[model samples]
Target: MGKWSNQINGRGNWSFTKYIYDNLYNFQWINRENNEIEDNLILTKSISLERVEQYIYFKDIFKGEYFSKLLEIPEALEELKIHMPEGYKTKEDIIDVINSRALNPNLKALDMSLPTHLNFVLISLNLPPHEGEVNDPMEYIVDALEKKYTKEENN
Candidate 1:
């Protein structure tokens, strides 16, 4: 098997991690083969904020239902109350808040099956809040990928 297939197989079933890995790996290979100095590969697909919100809401709802035996609906609601942003009472409001804060402006569409757009979505979701500064996790990931792929350029 080729290197990409081997990496994908090794990553197993974590969708987000696998997505990031695939993009970074492929970009690195391209840069190496072409001897090009590129910071990031342009994302072809774009995801709407509405879609992102829907995914988050669905994921949360599914988890609530799937783990109902261990996690009560009331408890889940309480957690949502604490973590969810102010003025975000309904599911739609919460999704709006998440989209406004988490979704990268450069993102175009959702391609969950591939790394193109999903990597940016995952980056936004996975980024931790900074103490005083706004954190754009997608940029951080791009920087990391660039560094990883262009180490020779640095030296």
Candidate 2:
């Protein structure tokens, strides 16, 4: 097993946030599916924590219509399945307990910084650096959904 860090969220259930905080670069672009395409672009460069924050902000700006509903455990799991690529599944085992605890004031207070069970789905994938690049594949997921979301919201 890899090293893990467990932090209690508002309801006190442990949020297992696993990541190798390292020099990583990632970028996502548009493409046609099932068509032969060549990508020679690289989005790699050493970025500061501030840049990560900027990326996260830029990331959050393109929110999906169903995003807010995902705070509810079941909705979140379903959203994960839809948003994420196949072979990865969120652990439903904690849904009931998490939903129940969502009513707690403490959890509510800490909700903004908390990771729900759906987060585990990404953690479970354990995607790593590829092609001499160390970017997390999961990050591409956000980019993919954001484009769809933007088109949807604009229409």
lDDT tens digits by residue: candidate 1, 49-135: 221111222223223234344334666556665766667665555445544524432232232322444354545655333333323
In model 2, which residue pairs have backbone atoms overlapping below 3 Å? 10-107
For candidate 1, the TM-score is 0.21
Root-mean-square deviation of Cα positions for candidate 1 versus the true structure, in angstroms: 17.8
**lDDT, candidate 1, residue 9?**
39
What's the alpha carbon RMSD for model 2? 17.7
| Candidate lDDT values, in order | 0.39, 0.38
Q: How far off is residue 21 in model 2, in Å? A: 22
Worst lDDT run of 10 residues, candidate 1, spans 48-57
The top-ranked prediction according to TM-score is 2
Write model 2 residue lDDT over 96-120, tens digit each, in one string: 3333443355444333332333244
